[model samples]
Target: MSSGDGRAPGPLLLLLLLLALPRSAGRRRAVVNRSIPDVCATCHIHATCQQSGGKSVCICNYGFVGNGRTHCQDKDECQIGASKICGNHTLCHNTHGSFYCVCLDGYRASNNNKTFIPNDGTNCTDIDECEESGLCGHNARCVNTEGSYMCYCNDGYKLETGEHSFHQDENNVSCKEIGCGSPPEMKNGYIVGNYSVQPGSAVHYECREGFYSNEGKFSYCTENGTWEPATLSCKEIDCGKPWLIPHTTMTWDNSTTLWSRVYYHCKEGYYFNGDKNFSECTMDQSWENITYVCEEEELFSNLSIFNETCVRWQKKTGRLGVQEMYTFHVQGQRWYQKNFFHEMTFELFTHKQAPEVCLDLQPGTNYSINISMVALNFSLLVSMTTQITDPPFPEVEFVAVKGSAPLLRLRKAEDQNGPISLYQVIVLPLDLQSTFICDSFAATTFFSNTTDIKGYVAAEFQAKDVADNMSIALGDRHYYGKFYNAPLKLGQEYCVFLKIISEWNKVRTQSCVIWAQIKNLSPSLQYMTAVGLGSVAAVCLVLFLSFSVARSCLHRSVHPPPAAVACEAVHLSTTVDVASAGIASLFLETESVSLL
Candidate 1:
């Protein structure tokens, strides 16, 4: 008013000045809204007043709203118009005074999953959870859709806890191995060792005797029902190279592929102990589990002492008893012979040390005898022939002149009922006497037993052709060798006795077999001489013919025939010469054949 000059009325000017000054908030609260304000001063700075209910009231401005005094809520301009104020794919959320635009669950702001303002030029972009690291653990697959994620186990693996989706933080979901299916089928053999068939589990296989493994030796279970290159197979077992026995040479039918016996022998000057000398290559691809040892003769003081622990292997030399003539011994030998007990009669041709009783005995440096007999009782008679040779020690054993020795044999026990016979015709009658001979020997004894036996010796036993699934024993029970007598001094003779006892085992079976027949195998000198002379005569004839042919060829080459000479006059004489040369080559080959 003062500026307008003229000095307006003082009271009026004072009233106008009071209205110009701003009123305190506390004072304004006390004053009720009874009149309309000339300006927007009664309301918040951003608000205005309006008439309502016949009274002036504070109201929010067009872009702001609230109680109108303390605060002013901003209008969501982004949500107002039909045209999206926040733009496409942008979320509008009202804030304290304004609103913000952001992407939806699957959409991001400005190509990123972040909050942004609309009209600030930000656009929503899809979130790809799959692209993020740590979304899935090992052996898992991840897929993203919208704002969600999913996970799956890789091949050979399954989700843990039957879960179908991936987990974060808690990480409750995981991939676990879904082991391979049942292990490969085994043929000709069976699996052993490991009991599990899960992935990474291993199993071993073994082939039966006389067979080998043609495919996998050992196999393992793998992921996804797959095997890691290992397969199951078996053909026949192969016992590679003989069992490792030092200082011994192996003797086996090398022609055989498997399960053949491998006999061992100590080198000269070395003697066999009770150690193993023979082991069979079993179908399980393993040699008989027997240990062997050899000692030197120097360790033994008196060689004859070994006679007590005698071991022998004998071969046939001849069949003398069949041809020789001798008196009936049934009358004289009845006292000591088994014929007295069994009522069996057989022949014998022998020389003994008794100067009186050996009346018909031929005088000899050493005891020599020949014998051949047959048991009239059995259906088929299995014969076993034996011959002995001088060993590195004194071998003949002599007892007091008495019949106290046993005359028992397994053939008597073979009559037992209900037991299977080891050999259909293997029989040896015992004829032991006080003055009989004893020597070392080795022998193979085959016996089959029921389930009661504690030490099972054989299974699926096979010697030459015999085989079975039942338990059995082969060879000597203690020595593990073929039974035989040793060191009869070649030309010398021996008093042989056959005896076996069938004790507790009523189901036992055994037999005796000959290795080979006796024969005089010496070649005739006359035949050898004749063959040599014939060969020499043929060689001489060939040499003479060769010389004659060479001379004829020389004559032809030096003096050409008239027909060949005529060819020289023609223009094709060189070709004619070549043809003649070919003919000469033919002649040479022909001569060579004739010579052969």
Candidate 2:
């Protein structure tokens, strides 16, 4: 079947001959067989040649990146001249056709913070561990840095770690307040309100009773935690009672019996109601006080008369619808002690003043006769006030707690329909000394040391109803007495004292002490004792008659009539004789029975 020497058979030769023929059997193309020009040479330096779509085309090689045909340039994926082409905070490395992105210092990436690929949806951001407050240990504040955070301690506190800050894991940071100064102690005055006061609190300091404000007052706690002004002091507040003036008796003018004007005295010549003089003392005893005061005793008297009557004289009296001129004839020799300020004043009485109502005051020596004449109504009152002023009133400013005119708040002494209410406000001298302030006065050790604690401007409030002659002492607890209801003019100024006297009792609670504020003070003050006198005399007469009737009955019972006495004796004798006869007959019967 096979030809010798591997020759093809007729059928196989015909197939080979057909395969060797051109793809088109019809015709053959005339080829200009000049050597084919190198197509790659027409392209750019970085380009290469390729045959595609039955044509020899010049193209840029895949590994060699370029823009387009005709002229091709090598593309730099690494962007060596123009940065950020890869991405910020990343290192770029040129490759065959692309670049590699490597994260730089303090940078991160979406896939991997240290290593990143270009065009990835991730950014290199700072590692802000400070976003958490507890990043640092206690009492430390966190501060963010490039890729880390820091800690710092607060003011006024110390860290136990010894450093300013420490990490949370250390567990050693603890804040403690800084040390302060030592606690302070006060003198003389104890803490007025609270003793155990803390820092940032307040403390009030005051002196003892009868003592003036020597040093301590108001103070505060410092940041160092101690009282600032810690010293205080108090001095004695006493000058015992002034010695007795010859032929004069003195008494206290307050119900407290201790807090008010100490010695209101009357000379022997002046008439006084014995019943009203409740504080007449004749003995002396030691006193118990913050400052020593003399204890008073009852007036000792052995002298007595068979009978005596009092004409109870008043120092100042209301006008009986008349004008009286009273002259104070000071001895001319005493004028040497008087100065420009030694002037007496006659203050007019009236809440509602009329310009025409004034006082005629003539301040002169004994030779000239200091006469004060006043025209007042029977319902009106007159007061003789004198003062040896210092520094003068015009120079001083008047500071009323509220104002010069205060509204009176007292029960009506009499209803508006009835007699008018009468009130009295007595303002004593500011420098009222028990010391012998006059030249002619006897030299005595009575008021030796009464410098600081003079009666702290005591006041007596009294209300009277002239119609009923009934007086009431008012200043009870209900009445707010810190305010004065006296009629004070706006432009006028005078000496005043405000400290209260602290003594045996609270005078403010006394009804009589604050009466002026309770009732309106009238310009008129009429003392009407005659109205009650008749009633008192009637009561005494009734008791006298009652005693007389009892005495007559007692006399009758003590002495019996003579005839009754004789009859009683006769009856007693007859009864005795009858008893004796009966006894004798009984004895005889007994003897006869024995014989039988």
Candidate 3:
């Protein structure tokens, strides 16, 4: 049967039967009954539940639930428990078996949650909303709100972009803008606005018009970014063309500017401005700084006569010669002494007439006279003077020897005059001594061949005068003799004489005597013959020894020896054949046959 609730009666009956068993069995039945609910509810409950095998069984409080499986899920407590779990200033959030707290409205969760837990007070945290974009104005500060922020600019500042606040951090920052003034202006040759006028920028330099900038162009900035250091100069300063001065010629080209050359010359009578010959123009537009003068030409006379002074003769000191004369003029007049006088004899006349008289006085007959003139009117008188003359005939002295080549020499006594002429030399042999005026000088050289004449040989020299008068004789007699070929006897005496011839046929002679003795020579024939014999004997002995030694060497070389066993085995040999059989036999026989 079944229970009234439509439950199966079998389960109920089984329950009763289990209970009717013994006490221990029945207690065991009750325990099994209790385990059945846990197992059954595990799959059907939420939250708090017991798990049976793979199923969960529990029931959770509000905002918490669980599936019939193992896991539990939370409900949005902030939405569902808004009024109860969280206060007005907080929010609540649900999680598995719990709820989170969060601030609401102007308040925020202290723990940073969006929901609040039941009975958990909410903490309202300050919100730094100023960190968000657009929270601060440009050049302004930002303030945080409960849930928002506000922007405000600083005093005396404005935003770059017109807005309550700039959205970006970089956009909100602002700085003052810098502006450039006007650029400097240039005048004259230069144009304005040529350079940039920005602050701290520089303006370049340039020249103006005909005036070149001495330095760089002066530059200054105006209030409106315009600058003009100073007006560029345009004043006219001309370098004029150079000009030539009077009586001067310029050498420089017209195109030259700084330097130019000008040459100046003097007129016929006037001098140059500087040097008499030339002048130059200077850069200061002035002529040569110096001057010169010219003088007149000097005059010279063609002919004039000055006074004559007395002059001593160059060749003769106090006297003069007849052939020498001195003639001079004074104011065109000739003065001289006429007759070889010792004092001045004056005569006045013109140059032509004076020269005529001088010619007359200078004739050949007056060669010994010397004349000279003194101051204008003074005349030097002179006479014929003569110097000492050398004697015409030269002295003759000489010596001669018989049978010898005799020489005769003539010399002047004073050596003042030159050589004498018209002189003759003579000789007389021993046979003609009496008549020996033989037209030759004494002892004049002669040759003889006869060997037996014994007598004095007389020789004489005579000098003839220009009048053809013969001078005294100069003679030299030499005693000589020719003897037989035998040696001359010792202690003999001899005489020799010499004579010289002079002009005018004058002759002078001299003589000398000397004794001569003969000297004997020693005889040496026997000593020479002995030396010859010794030399011959030495030669003959040398020849005999050489012949014997050569014969022995020939004999030894001609003989040969018999061959020996030991000698035949060796290759060495001598120029003389010692290995021959004949030589060996001879050597052995000689050795064995020595003299006993």
Using TM-score as the measure, name the better of candidate 1 and candidate 2: 2
Using TM-score as the measure, which candidate wins? 2
The C-alpha RMSD in Å for every predicted model, in order, reads 31.0, 34.6, 50.0
RMSD of 2: 34.6
Ranking of all candidate structures by their lDDT, best first:
1, 3, 2
The per-model lDDT (C-alpha) reads 0.43, 0.38, 0.38
lDDT for 112 (candidate 1): 53
For every model shown, what is its TM-score relative to the native structure?
0.25, 0.26, 0.19
Clash counts for all predictions:
26, 15, 82
Of 1 and 3, the candidate ranking higher by TM-score? 1
Q: In model 2, what is the error at residue 319, expressed in angstroms?
A: 30
The C-alpha local distance difference test score for the whole of candidate 1 amounts to: 0.43
lDDT of 2 at 437: 29
